[model samples]
Target: MTLPEAPRGRPRDTRAHQAILTATAELVAEAGYAATSIGAVAARAGTGKDTIYRRWSGKAELVYEAVFTETESGPVPDTGSLTGDLTALVEALVQEFSAPAAAAALPGLLADFAANPGLRSRIRGHFLAPARTRLAEVFERAVRRGEADSAVPVDLVLDTLAGAVFFHVGLVGEPAGPRLAGQLAGLVGRGIEAR
Candidate 1:
């Protein structure tokens, strides 16, 4: 007798997904991506290596998902004013980069992406574009409110603001406190100002 096909697209167990992501993040933080093997992750996650392989083809995909998952939520702070909103956004971005877990994983992830152009493309498509789109929405709102110029290039503006925050967190290695937030806000505000 022919057996009926198993149910397609079975709902994933949220707990398992979270456990894998947690295990992957901790491994990357402790050993860096290059050193984190699927076996190690499986052991840490209390699952079989086959389970991880079933979910992801390999380690890079798993690590990519782990790092990007941490920042899956869009960054859009509504502080009622453009300055307040931008300041909060930058501060949050800095916090993400500065977080020990993120800081440890991101550098390795970026290096891997550099080695593999395809992975870089995946990161841009999955992570960077969504972030840029969200920032563009904020810029659009500011333009509509007459707080920013409609003619400004949204990508350039976003890159400048985000780059400044990344520079501080990635390079300076210092806490991005209120003072840095205010400076970034001032720079972005000036760029947004109507000519």
Candidate 2:
């Protein structure tokens, strides 16, 4: 069933949106990205190809939304300490990346990110930018609390989290857990603490 046209964007059909997203994630995870095409996604979602195209510009856009927006969890955490916040954030990321579909989709997607600057930019804009901003805020609070040095670069925090998550889930194929996440958080905290 086609949704009645909306003025600015696709029809406000949440079910269709979610279905399309889930289908996209599943397809990419099941087949490589090269095999996950718009027509396939449309058929899998039981929606018209037009519906998928109406919402996203192309394959990268569709997959970016499916992987980032539809799956992101644990919104900006406020755990009082930088270590606590980082641990929570890292744990959430582990959960997100290690999910069945994401677990399957990520290895291929991560490879794509290395090769496609445009894909990286779109995903950074859609998801990572906000996450980085929240992390910056958490770092700021830590500095105020004397947990981190005032001079520590926020980039270090960002990179540390990224590295830890990727190293465990992407390279080693280990599920992310509180212990590992906590260790990473503690490492970031001590490494950047004011001398």
Candidate 3:
């Protein structure tokens, strides 16, 4: 479904935008996503619902941006080798998913994804696409260097790395650290390596 973009007009106020995102994160953390509402977010942000609606389509988009967008901060690392690259990528995923906002918001965001097909696509566009694009470069390098199969399924590799961390941190509530990241990278790296 095509969601409406914010009307083209005066640029949004940076302070107000940050306030809305911060308020959304705080409310989702304090009350859980199921209980947080657009009204509550507006109240906490000290802005009206119209201000938020002008920027985002609904709570799902707002919450996803507030909680998930920050995780895409830096570029994915390239360490000259598949295992090394995977380790860096996996470590970042572990850290991001384990953060307080992500830890709290993921479950609810995932629920929203299940119920809203449009949201699922939007999230993939906003959140997953960038990461996947960068990761595709990594995979290409590995293949060129003969470290991985030319026909390796990049999506499965991504799913394995991301899904494992999501289950460990988001669902099991376990703390994943660099060690786990290294181990996961090694395991997946070997699996995808020229075999």
lDDT of 2: 0.76
Q: For candidate 3, what is the TM-score?
A: 0.80
Report the number of the highest-lDDT candidate: 3
In Å, residue 22's CA in model 1 sits off its true spot by: 1.8
**TM-score of candidate 1 against the unseen true structure:** 0.78
Put down candidate 2 lDDT per residue, 1-195, tens digits, no spaces. Answer: 555565544554677888999899889878867788899999999999998888887777777668755424446778887778887877776766676666666666677777888777775456477677878888888888887888877766777788778778877888665588788878877788877
- Which regions of candidate 1 fall more than 4 Å away from where they truly are? 1-12, 47-61, 68-75
Q: lDDT values of the candidates? A: 0.74, 0.76, 0.83
Which residue pairs in candidate 3 collide? Answer: none
Look at candidate 3 and tell me the lDDT of residue 73.
64
Each candidate's clash count:
0, 0, 0
How far in Å is the alpha carbon of 112 misplaced in model 2?
3.0
Superposed Cα RMSD, model 3:
5.6
Estimate the TM-score of every prediction: 0.78, 0.77, 0.80
Please list the Cα RMSD from the true structure of every candidate, rounded to 1 decimal place.
Answer: 5.0, 3.8, 5.6
lDDT of 1 by residue, 96-186 (tens): 6776666777667767778987776776566567667767777778888888898888778767876787787876677777688878887
Cα lDDT for residue 172, candidate 1: 69
Q: What does the lDDT read for residue 130 in candidate 2?
A: 68
lDDT by residue (144-173, candidate 3, tens digit) is 999998788787887899899889987899
